[model samples]
Target: MSAYVVVELTVKNAVAKDLYSAAAGPIIREFGGEFIAGGAWSALAGVQGHPQGAIIRFPNRDSALGWYNSAAYQATLANRDARMTCSFRLIGN
Candidate 1:
């Protein structure tokens, strides 16, 4: 089954976010994942959870989890954590 990583976030440091994104993108691709949608979001109903969000599609759940847990990706966490407040969830399709 395909899998998706859904992220809801608020950026605190744009520079750091950019750097993190640059570094993370390649690793995601290497793990068979690609970003399908991202950027500012609007609330159609109820309360919005966050101002921005992203969705990454992967070949499978294992690929998504592997990308997230891989050493290369894990190394970017310190920067990502400092630059944003976010939530990531894995959804199986």
Candidate 2:
């Protein structure tokens, strides 16, 4: 089964957001994740989201978790933490 990493983040600093992506993107790809969507959206539901949301699909749950736990991704989080709050959820697809 495929796995999806869904993230919602409130960006307090755009500069840090860019830095976060620069560091995290290659690590995600290194673990075989594909970016499905990462951007603002039009809300058509009862619940509204933060300013940013991203969907990344991985080959499986293990791969997704591996990417998330990898040092590269961890570094990105460390840097981003000062400028944003991020939450991630994993769903099987």
Candidate 3:
């Protein structure tokens, strides 16, 4: 089974967000995860949750959870508070 991390976010500081993304990418890869899709979005129906979003795919639920809880990823998130407002959900299939 595969797992995904779906993120809905609105960036407040582009510089900080870029920095965070750069720093987090390698750590995600190290844990067997890769970003499958991301970018601006439009609402076709229902409530528009956020202006931007991304989906990260992992080999399995354990890999997804491992990346999220890893020390390196946690460090990257330390400065994200001033960069964006976001929500992350984990799903498996």
Models sorted by lDDT, best on top: 1, 3, 2
lDDT of 3 by residue, 36-83 (tens): 999987789999898999999999999999999999889878677678
Error of 3 at 30 (Å): 0.5
lDDT of 1: 0.95
Best by TM-score: 1
Q: Model-by-model lDDT, in order? A: 0.95, 0.87, 0.91
Per-residue CA lDDT of model 1 for 1-93, tens digit only, reads: 899999999999889899999999999999999999999988899988879999999999999999999999999999999999999999995
Worst 10 residues of 1 by lDDT: 41-50
Task: Score candidate 1 by TM-score against the native.
Answer: 0.95
Q: List candidate 3 stretches off by more than 4 Å.
A: none
TM-scores vs. true structure, each candidate: 0.95, 0.89, 0.94
Q: Which is better, 1 or 3, measured by lDDT?
A: 1
Model 3 weakest 10-residue run by lDDT: 73-82
CA error at residue 7 for candidate 2, angstroms: 0.7
**Angstrom error at residue 51, model 3:** 0.5
Please give the clash total of every predicted structure, in order. Answer: 0, 0, 0
